[model samples]
Target: MGEARYSRQIPLIGEEGQERLGRSSVAVVGLGGIGSPLSLLVAAAGVGRIRLVDWDLVELSNLNRQILYTSRDLMRPKPFVAAERISLLNPRVEVEVVHEPLVPGNADSIVEGVDLVLDALDSLEARLALGDACQRAGAPHTYAAVQGLFGLVTLIVPGETPCLRCILPERPREEPAFTVGPVPALVASVSASEAIRILSGRGPSLAGRMLVVDLSSPSFEFIELSGECPHRPPEPPPRPAYFRRGDRLYAFEADPSGWERLERRGWAVVEESDAYVRLSGPGSVAVFYSDGGALLVGSRGEGDFREAVGGDLEDL
Candidate 1:
């Protein structure tokens, strides 16, 4: 029965690949739409250890795409809920849940000891932070993003492939608002399949290339990023400072003293200016004074800021 569970994948991945999957570890950030399915697939494929992280509660809206959760899981923390389901699905696979968000401050630690990192987050800030951390840590990372009927997937092999920042240079001053439905299920399956392929060494990986899929148009596109582009020097001490004000945005060099506390509160810079700093909130954007740090009440447009932060600021 145990062997029967993965009998199908074994023939495809082979015994050697199965062993590799069993010996390898993967850290999945976010247990919603993408992360949930990604985590479950990795576990079902017999990954030795899986680290699941998310600081969100299950909601009725999540049932549409977050396959890891059920009606019984409503109001439960995502990581914990995912861990429980994974345990029931495959006891041989170990599942570690971190009931917290991934930020610059603890990204390395959370990602430490893992063979690969997968971005299943909804926000651009978290995705950027994870990409930066993976680059510095020299760990392989796969990024997947979805909006409406479209989804994009990319594989970053540390110094070899274009880092996330290489594609997106300027962090956005505001967050993008969009909706997901059964589309995430399809997106997650594609993302998880890519990860499995990379893990099993079955086919050419997506490294150095972006896979864009549009379910609406039902089309696929691949874009290769130039390798000659420069990358920002890695920060020695990953800071938790990111804020925005008006049209200006600022990211601070984290101060060790209070950085952890700040990250726990999800205090990230959404935008910054000489006059004010913008912070992210639950589906809202808040701005603050740069000097006095007083709150600035207002609203702005939405989209992944990291997509804007790295390569060229001109388009933004």
Candidate 2:
């Protein structure tokens, strides 16, 4: 058993570290491009128990970087496919697959027994929900995202370090349409390496800092997170209307739902004809589309929308 399976990693992580890994539990969310390889590394590394979560089905477009699946596996639920692969890779590693999408309501139970959580999601909404769940669960989470040649890795240790929400108050509104090609491999490799380091209890984890990599530029940079929590005044009880367009553009109001109700009543309407939607309210405005996708205009026509959205955008 020892001759072929883990000889290469033995010297680095050692039998003790391997044993530790075998005893620890890890939960990986989103079994897509980044998640596929990341989960493989964790399972192959001898992680004692692995919990996989994803609601998405495999698609042909994902084969370029999702190493866990092939043409034969297309259309199958990702968590199921990943679990099957992990068992074949190492039966010693117990694999648990949560086939449904993770939401705020079920996040606590999903993360309950895991020592670490890995974010491999494609949408900011899911990431934020996971972050909130991890925080409430007091579990450490490692987040990774890639777009084109750029990738980002961040480690959040609940109250010990800055939470994802603390650093990014608002979720990214728009998703970027990107070409995967070989970028996911690079990002997933780096993210998996970081997870290994965490598992071995070796090296300084990328906690409290965002590790940004640009493969096109072939450059790596670290952005220090502000330790102080940025505080925002509480909105009035009813809450205001807010909608995000594309990755960076956003419109908000003291009452966001009011506009939605008005839209439903046909009192307010946006022509979806031009790839642009009109969001009306205190923050009513028309968002323009760009080559990248929808331009993120924040709070209607405010020039500050661009800067605010640009600064908070995460590429995945």
Candidate 3:
């Protein structure tokens, strides 16, 4: 390859960094709004290999945000079109197309051998599944989503940072949402930058923090999350101590000071009884028992109690 191809970025990241990027592999798990521009940028950055995964054919309406697909691409499978376009952008990069939706059964295979995973999914459930798959594969993933003019991006480094399940424990079960053109492209650029930084070790990554963008208010917010994730193994359970309610999980804690500890960490005591002391927070609920048993519950569609507590409690 010619130095002129990377003449601009090399000054900032150095030739060594450019070469490092050439040796890395990444997976872009979606080919719509965010995924489209994200895949293009990832290839243009000179990443050695990229796996493009998406099952849907490009629809005419997607043209507004999915820049990788043109009017001619309508009715074409996204992965194939994306692979073709990305290949043309950087023939030096190997582009692999997976014309399938990412389900739990196939997510691991998609993430396997990839140095990074770029999650550009709109569905919260698919993002959750991809997060779990990355956890299982021990791959770092940059997750971003856009809904209308608002979007968020975060980087998860398998065991080192919180996974999506930790960041958002409860699965959102809403109908498909709307998004504009520039919103996803902006978030996707951030996601691509995180991937480049991680691959080249050139800049700071958003491993444990979230970047929230609200174009409506024209504001950007960065939030640091408590470093906890489902990938960490849960400690052994105490007799009949773990259970679940709906999407929320419940667990009995034997520590008398557990409630106190939670209170110190911002959990508010909401209700109490000889048998139970219930505590509440923005996204979780906890119940303490006089018999040294406690129950922790997750908020529906918001957060997960099990991930917060580092427990294995799941829906019954």
Candidate 4:
């Protein structure tokens, strides 16, 4: 890599910081509105290794906010397209694209050892899975989400600051699903700054606070959430395919529409909701969410849970 490429910003971060960025690796999950611009910025800034992950094919609707793709790139997988763009942006940078969904089953493999994990994902299920996985492996996770004209950004350091769970305790219902083009672009810029600062050894600026940006009101508010902090889990899960934390047990792979599958299989439903369903199984009560997560309650172990579900983990 040539020093001339980053000559302008070298004065600010110093050559040592630039060298750190060259050696650092990052996993950017969800190459959508936020991920698109964020990837470009991070790459242009000379991040050494960028792991672009997204399984969706580009469509006409994505053209509005996803700057990485154009009309000609439609119907192509995002990771591949992003990889090509990043390679062209910085030929010296090492780019890896994984064309797969980010779920609990594969979260560890994707997020485990990355220098930082950037979340541009829209769904809560993926966020939960990514955050938990990053926390487990002691990886830094940069979380950003857009809601219409507003967006939020926060940097999560395992034992120093608040986590994604602190802000998003439950699922976001509707507003965030749709966003204007500029909202995510702005959010991604902030997120990229956080990632760059951390990679440069300046540490995270938003570690203790959540930045709420409202375009309509034109104000940025820093909400305090510094009191919460937790260290990495002392023990790993029992199996490679599962993520176990406290009473909740997440299968390595699970169908987001698992409740429907359970209903088709004639599993007795103890309770049901739009988000999840509680089903009475052989050894325990199982709760499955609509987006990708499972809870095994009152069960002896994985064996019993697998038997209760009557199939493989992915089949559920």
Tell me the TM-score of each prediction against the true structure: 0.72, 0.70, 0.72, 0.73
- Arranged by lDDT with the best first, the candidates are 4, 3, 1, 2
lDDT of 3 by residue, 68-184 (tens): 988986545577778778778889999887755565556778889988889988777667778877887788888898888899998888778877777876766675658789999
Candidate 1 lDDT over residue span 85-116, tens digit each: 89999999988766555667767787788988
Residues 74-137, candidate 4: write the lDDT tens digits: 6455777898899888998899867556667677889866799999987787788888888888
- Stretches off by above 4 angstroms in model 4 are 174-176, 229-316
lDDT of 2: 0.67
Whose lDDT is higher: candidate 3's or candidate 4's? 4
By TM-score: ranked, best first: 4, 1, 3, 2
Q: How far off is residue 134 in model 1, in Å?
A: 0.4
Q: What are the root-mean-square deviations of the candidates from the true structure over C-alphas?
A: 11.1, 12.7, 17.8, 11.0
Error of 3 at 247 (Å): 26
**Tens digits of lDDT, candidate 2, 1-316:** 2446889987887777767777888999888888998899888888888999875556677887788999996545567779889999988889886755555556667788888898888888667778877877788888888876788888888767788778667766655637464677777777777777887777546888888888787788999875754432222222223444344344332222232333453333443323223343233332222112222222344444333233222210
What is the lDDT for 105 in model 3? 55
Tell me how candidate 1 scores on lDDT: 0.68
Measured on C-alpha atoms, candidate 4 has an lDDT of: 0.77
Error of model 2, residue 184, in angstroms: 1.9
Q: What is the overall TM-score of model 1 with all chains considered together?
A: 0.72
Candidate 4 lands at a TM-score of 0.73
Compared with the true structure, all predictions reach lDDT values of 0.68, 0.67, 0.75, 0.77
Question: How much is the lDDT of residue 70 in candidate 3?
Answer: 89
